[model samples]
Target: MKETDLAVGNTTVGLSRTLVWLMAIISGLVVANNYYNQPLLALIADELHVSESAAGKISVLTQIGYALGLLLIVPLGDKLLRKRLILIDLVLVIAALLWMTFARELWMLYVASLLIGATSVIPQLFVPIAAQLSNDQEKSTNIGLVMAGLLLGILLSRFFGGIVGDWWGWRSMFGIAAGIMVFVWFIIYKMLPEIHPNFKGSYKQLMLSVIELARTQPVLQLASFRGAMAFGSMSAVFTTLVFHMEQPPFQVGASVVGSFGLAGAVGALAAAKVGKLQTAIGTYRTILYSLLVLIGSWGFTYFAGETYWGLIIGIILLDLGVQGSHIINQTDYFTLKTDAVNRLNTVYMVSYFIGGSMGTWLASIAWQYAQWEGVCAVGATFGLLGLVAHLLLSRKIRLAAIKT
Candidate 1:
């Protein structure tokens, strides 16, 4: 099949720039559900009568749910009407958010968080759809544009959640989130076009393909590993930041920690431009330099205890590096199988969020034992592992090319 022949269900559809931006916006809004609870953990704990440690589990469980969704739900994009799948998922997201707002017990909130994360995989669905819609020359640019919105939503979730939670209450933040999701659902229902399903196989076969792809594809494996480490490191910092900021020198509130997300947002916005550069600089090179920046960001974060400037700079670098590497990985992987973009994303993202959940769990443990310094060490270690893995993989690729 040619690059332009994007199989939607029974027909091929071309994506317009306007449509792409709309998808980007929807992705941004929906994915924000997972992160909103991060900054609000402290507030939620106090209100719900849970300890800070127990509250951290909310974020971890949400990410775990996201990983589960990536494995189970995203592959359906290739087997079902894409728009319908997205619309159905959006309704679930709204329902989950509402459930969160009205939860009276800790268990209720935990279940709601899981549902929210699982259903919020709409962004993942949009990504593959966007990739399928674009021609080769425009693919990276289009994905980057959509990714910018997704990244902005991630960074701003904390900002909005913090401010809203501080002013009204944590429950109010969920109420507002549900309202935004409802509006997003309507826009998608009306504007998003349906695509032909490429995979006609049974659901079991579709899942088997996901497992087979992971077992066989070296690029997928390397990309997944690289993404896992980068995201793990990033999650560690954000997950533990509230605890750090609440301590002696800073004595700050969740809103202040939430405001730091703005710096990361700036970095995420730059990723669109960086995506354009991947064609000129090469994908591995982009990933290499991005990982380097990530390492440096953790270095700054290590010393963030003394000054807020350190945390700000660290966040900017962290977001820029992670987003750039992610775009490069997706762009490369998408090219491997046009018919399998959704499955490819499923494998890559499942690995990515698993890493994130692990990082959050690790950071929570680290905070209990070694505090801020331990969190920084955990983050930096993950960054270093990613950088080293990329180097080894690049060398192997070069040697293989020379042999051929």
Candidate 2:
């Protein structure tokens, strides 16, 4: 039997490379909707005649909406047909994008951005699906590849959206995004399998089960906390970066600020093998090392006000650390309970994006108070807290072992 062609249940169907890669591409496109607004915030502010601070709130609101979706909508993956859910989300996001295209007020745009984030969670379903398809040996690698695509979508949104917004306008960017989703929706319909749900319960029970799982699982708690802090560090940097680039020695435009995402993209692509690192060392150890790298990223960012190179270097390390640990945590948490992969992810990701929201919100305040230095400080502090969290988890595990 071919390794990648092993049977799943009573069927001969298995993890085909083409199928996995296709899922990755679709996942990338779906997730890209949430981030297209990041680099365009300044442009939108100017066009709509609002404060940059007010404009930045849209990013925070998007993340919060995403967290809400993760908590509310994603658990349905375990209870409903995933393909149907994905298609429904795609339709909703397209509608939201159209709303964004014609929004004439900040509140209108804010509501549309929130809806876009809520519906753009379709890609997240792919992660659990990828995990379910692979055997234990290949789980991390497959997840890493899908994650690489998702990360690319995130980084590339900034790059592409900045250019689109610069050439056209922020409204035009959303209009274009809506058209792209129409094509993506058809592709998803053709490619996705109609997998049966693992859970058979009322919506209330399914949700209660998620809470029960969270309460019982210490691993889930530790991993979620780590993922939260690591991602918060990255989000703070990315959210405030555009504002920084508009200042002082480097008074570049949206396209240039967005181009810096290429550095983070480089980090994300390089860290795709982090799963192998987790295989070699332990998963938690890899997570620990990643947090250290995350903290170290701040040193470069602190000096970013002086030179563009520092910001570029900082983005590379920051993304490497955050994305690497994220892959590790994501893969490891699924091992806790196979039947509840979607719920497990729902918990992990809800925390992850909440951290992201907090980072964006706090960094806005920091930008006002201490500018780039404060932003760097906030990012580094989250990394440090994650490192400390790892130490706490390690001690807890050791103590539990001793008792046993």
Candidate 3:
């Protein structure tokens, strides 16, 4: 067998199971920092003397920072010592979190938020490492396990942040997040093994190669586009949901807003199943199903204009669809270039974050004009676009399969 094929095949079976779990835990802690400020946006706005619209920029700036990190930091995973990179990034993230806690003005907070996003590439590093280490047979399951940790981390950060911010101060949430990072940093140092360089080239050449891969890779393009659209739509809903819940008839508290993350968590559970389904249904068909579910989710929201249960059901369905599509996209993209995981990630995630930021920005404006209906319309429109993209690509995708 070819060397890359051998690596792929051997990566799945008979690995150190304990180490797998350890990586997942460490990765989750590192990734959770990205979402810590989300649920507390309203609190941050009040404390920082910014408008809610401006505070919403926190989410955008953070995502932009993450995109930059994915572009610059993640690619180093292929060229440098992965363990060292991860450790350094973790330290940087903690420092950024500390700065956020002490941030006295808008610009300071913006700078701190950017740094936090930039260094939060820890999860990206972890996923590629897990893929590299797994045997082929167990690769998907291992990836799913690690991702489940990630999804849980994303879901719970909001809950924990809300509770901590409510009980103490908004700054306390960052302090707690920083403390968690400190603990995880040590655990990673002791437990995670170092990775050797895979692509030995100058930084310029490495970057050029990654760009070329992104430029030519159809699967990467397709997955990145689909992933972004789905994420952007999801971001639109989430950005507006808190405002809706906090205002008007609902008047829910921060804790309750944070609690809605549970629905997303329940939806996120579907990611693992999507991974398994990929082997059976093929990536394209699975994406179609996910898009339909996403659209149907928005339809539920229309009914939810008057009822909380309707909103809850819509949120759950929307999350499941979004999370499931995300897993499939990652799996598909990973298969495109085994050795170029980090760069592939940079390309895919840069596009993904763009979608997320756009969604949030547009959602904010839409919320102003159309309220909940506007948000739902944007989300449903994005889903429809995705469905159309998939159908147009279907023939070419089939041809590519035949050639393979």
Candidate 4:
């Protein structure tokens, strides 16, 4: 329950199941702010008198903001009081939500989204806290549990956003989000244990450390690149899904688009449960399996996009692939740096953010040219790229394993 107790020299502090779940829940709610605008983009656009194309900037800007935060803020966790930092970030997020609720112009929404993205760094804080609290042996498993909640939040935030927007209005969704944030903030304060800093490195040293990590760790480099590519594929699929569903062929409602969260749920759950597979089979093998699913899912679009069941199956497969690959990547990366979790996270998350941005940008362009087919092509292309990366690295990775 106390930070000092966890400092018992590499031994776990014996966290209760209830405590862990409570922390994960709070972390999930705080992180959900980043995606709240995504499902409601159409509604936000209409209210602000912009086209859907124009409203796409919301997702773009928020992602940029998140990337900036990952670079600027997450590194502080290694040197700061994580509980206090998380609390402060939560307050900032609440203010950003309030700004979103009151925004009268599209530009105002964009600015608020930037702040929301920056403050939604709470999830990053929880990752380090989770690592610090766990024993050496349970590190991956604990991280996986927290990641399951985090990914579920990332997936379901859109569902909550769209449902609230549909039932009330777009602005009301932010107001409701603010209320939820306020409540979650209270829970977080009561539940999360304080984490004493283990490394109080200077900013320059931290930045340099991340660079050194990039250079020294072959697995980190490959995993980060593969992660970015895989996420880019997913982003391409997600960014274009609304457009495809809203237009002529499907004409689906926002609620239906939001229901993709169910597929995400399946995927997150699968990742959390497959820790043994990742540990035994290795990151590359799991990534290979996930990539195959991604390829199959994209190919399924040829037959499934028009049919209800087919669409559902495609989404399920897509979510499973993306989430599974993500788990493997994170589990592998975290193992590389025992003492510098923040730096490791900073590098990995930056890749993730970059990938998401590229995917979104490409999806927009692809939609303009080849529509949904183009998006699927992009997804499959990334999967193939990942396959190649894995194959090229296989010999080296196996050699490194034998040496270890």
What TM-score do all the candidates reach, one by one? Answer: 0.96, 0.95, 0.93, 0.92
Query: Model 2 misses residue 159 by how many Å?
Result: 0.4
Ranking by TM-score: 1, 2, 3, 4
Q: Point to the candidate with the largest TM-score.
A: 1
| Alpha carbon deviation, residue 41, candidate 3 (Å) | 1.2
Q: Estimate, for each residue in 140-170, the C-alpha lDDT of model 3 and write its tens digit.
A: 7777777777877877777777778788978
lDDT values, one for every candidate = 0.87, 0.86, 0.79, 0.77
lDDT of 4 at 352: 83
Ten contiguous residues with the weakest lDDT in model 3: 1-10
- Ranked by lDDT, the better of candidates 1 and 3 is 1
Off by over 4 Å in 4: 1-14, 401-404
Clashing pairs in 2: none
Rank by lDDT, descending?
A: 1, 2, 3, 4
Candidate 1: C-alpha lDDT: 0.87
Best by lDDT: 1
What is the lDDT, from 0 to 100, of the residue 25 in candidate 1? 89
Q: Summarize candidate 2's per-residue lDDT along 122-159 as a digit string, tens digits.
A: 76788988887888898999999999999999999889
